[model samples]
Target: MVKVEFAAALQRHVPCAPQSVAPGTLRAVLEAALAAAPGLAHYVFDDQGAVRKHVAVFVNQQQVRDRVRLDRPLADGDSVFVVQALSGG
Candidate 1:
């Protein structure tokens, strides 16, 4: 199973949640996560449903490219971490 971790900013949406999910592509993972916490969809993706610029997705410790192609395939035991980028100046 692939693990999905929500950053502190996202924890409010999912309380006491597991950090893993069934093995699948990024799309599948996000879909399932959204299914469980529909409210997160709007915060993570844009109106067009694309991952927002400030959102980052890491698979197995490798950062995923910012594109719809996050559909990148995943295997069992992999991990997917979803975090919101923070910026201040």
Candidate 2:
């Protein structure tokens, strides 16, 4: 199973916990995790189902490059971290 964790900053708004989801593409893993806290989907994804511009997702410490497709493959035991990106001066 893939281990998915939301950053503390993000959790403050939606209150989600780290969870293990079936190994699959990034989209699948996110869907499983969000199932527990459906409201969180709004913070992570935009209206078109693409990752929000202010959100970032990392797999095994590497940042994912495809925000729109979210096709990055995840394997069992892989660690996925979702965080709200900081911006502004």
Candidate 3:
């Protein structure tokens, strides 16, 4: 199983807990994890189903490059971290 965790900053708004999901693409893993947390999807994805500009996803501590498709594949034992991206000068 792939481990998915949401940052504390984001959890304050939606209260999602870290969970284990079936190994798959980033989108598939997230879909499975977020399915248990109502309203959390709106904060992570936009109307087009792309990751929101303010969100960031990392796999095994490396940042994901494809936010639009979120097709990065995950294997068993991989760790996925989702956080709110910080911006501004």
TM values, all candidates = 0.84, 0.95, 0.95
The sequence of per-residue lDDT tens digits that candidate 3 reaches over residues 1-89 is 99999999889999998999999989999999999896899999999999998899999999886889888889999999999888874
lDDT of 2 by residue, 1-89 (tens): 99999999888998988989999999999999999999999989999999998888999998886899988788998999998777874
- How far residue 78's Cα lies from its native spot in candidate 1, in Å, is 0.6
Task: Show where candidate 1 strays beyond 4 Å.
Answer: 13-16
Error of 2 at 71 (Å): 1.2
Could you tell me which residue pairs clash in candidate 3? Answer: none
User: Model 1 over residues 1-89: C-alpha lDDT tens digits?
Assistant: 87777777777765436556777878888777667677777877888878888888777777787656667888888877778776654
Give lDDT for model 3: 0.92
Between candidates 1 and 2, name the one with more favorable lDDT: 2
Ranking by lDDT: 3, 2, 1
| lDDT comparing candidate 1 with the true structure | 0.75
TM-score of 2: 0.95
Q: What do the candidate models score in CA lDDT, each in turn? A: 0.75, 0.91, 0.92
Q: List the residue pairs that clash in candidate 2.
A: none
User: Which sections of candidate 3 miss by over 4 Å?
Assistant: none
